[model samples]
Target: MVYDLAIIGGGPSGITAGIYAARQKMKTVLIAKSFGGQMAHKTVDIENYPGFDKISGLDLIEKFENQLKGKNVEILSEELHAIVKENDSFKISFEDGKFINATAVIIAAGAKPRKLDVEGESEFLGRGVSYCTTCDGPLYQGKDIVIAGGGNAGFESAIFMQNYANKVYILEYGPEARADEENQKRANENGKIELIVSADIKKIQGSAFMEKVVYADRVTGEEKEIKAQGVFVQIGYSPASHIVEHLADLNQRKEIIVNHDTMETRTPGLYAAGDITDGFLKQVVVAAADGAKASMSAYKYLQSKNG
Candidate 1:
């Protein structure tokens, strides 16, 4: 059956949209590869989300999913391949050669962490190198680990790792950290965290997993090696928008360009929200707000078409 609205992700943005759309009695279907998106693997405790002093990333997403359990929103575990407009409707294609037609579409695929692209980085993924500290930090309890980056994500991971790891080294390529002052203060207070600035990771060495990090000082061009069992890379993130690249307009960073008010893209029936849209801060609260705006715009668009 054709759905009234097809949400293209299952993260906070899409799930929140599904909740809103379904509550409106609109036929909504949530198509996603997974349930939680990036929040699934975070090992840190999140206090930013409302109504909770502290909660695990996965647990919060699970609560979101549980809220929609009995709703009309149909949750499908499918990988969206491409989207195309046809007449007044939209057609969504899946990787398994399946198709779904909808009157409106909300694209909320979210983003993935940027890779270091250094030697042994790819091979050591999960084995010793991880992108989400909340997911893999506990595995390295009382072990030495290296965090590559000095941004908010890096500092957050460092603070989280202090709970489990014996020592945490933050290897940043810049002279100073880019993390928020509050987060930086907290990281500094944690005696276990060692901040190494202006250093670039040259190589991640190990046989089966990551065992050491070869770093080079950007200023003096001096080389230094640190022995560690695991490495958490939190340099930055790239939006997951390649599939819809041809269908929408993107900004300089390749993020979807949308009007802030309506969340409408270049296409009328198409809307984008969350980190996939061009923005500086990628936060869960902002994503939820975007989803609400997109849903309202979508509802208005549907009303105009029906009227």
Candidate 2:
């Protein structure tokens, strides 16, 4: 049977859209390679999201799962490879050679962390190089750590690692820090976290486990190396929009272009939300709200077509 809506993700936004769509009595199915998406990658505490004072990433994902248990939404552990438009509906294709036809599609596949394309970076991924601070910080307790990036994510990683690490070095490629003022202040007050501006990470050097990070001073063009057992690349992220790249209108960053108010994409009956959308705010709460909006807008679109 053709589903009414298909949410192509398992993150907060897709889960929220599934819950909302199921609540509206629509035949909705949520598909993903796995549940929780990037929300399960890190072990950080989420305080900004409402309802909980502070929740671990794993615990929060479990909570999201619990809320979706009896929601009548069909959750599929399928890897969405591509989406093709067919007639007036859409066909969702999976890597496992499965297909599902839906009247409306909600593309909520979230973004992934941007990796530092430097030497020894990919080789020592599990050895010492990491992308999630909260996930790998505990392992490097009492050891010197290096964090790349100057945005809020970088500072947040520094804040979390400062308590356990002997030294925390933040490398920002710009002249000044771009993180929120409050976070920068906290990082500065600790004194354990050192902010290095105008710095560009050149390479990571080590044997089996990471030993030191090599960087270049952008201003003076001087090369320097720091003793760091652990290196966390907290640069930024890129949307997981490759599956629908040719089918939808995407911006320069490859983020799906959608209406901020409705989450409707350029193509009718196709909607997107969360980090995949062209929105500045990348918060869980905002994603959840966007998911709700997308589902509601899809429901209306269905009603109009049926009427």
Clashes of 1: 4
For model 1, the stretches where C-alpha displacement exceeds 4 angstroms are: none
Kindly list the per-residue Cα lDDT of model 2 for residues 115-227, writing each as its tens digit.
98999999889888999876778998899999999898899889999878999999999999999898899888868999999999999889978899999999999999999
lDDT, candidate 1, 39-151, per-residue tens: 88776577999999999888999998998789998888998988889898998987778899999999999998999999889988888899888778899999999999999
User: In candidate 1, what residue range of length 10 has the lowest lDDT sum?
Assistant: 37-46
Model 2, total clashes:
0
**What's the TM-score of each model vs. the native?**
0.94, 0.94
Tell me how far the alpha carbon of residue 296 in candidate 2 is from the true structure, in angstroms, after superposition. 0.8
Q: What is the C-alpha RMSD of each candidate to the true structure, in Å?
A: 1.7, 1.7
Deviation of model 2 at 208, angstroms: 2.1
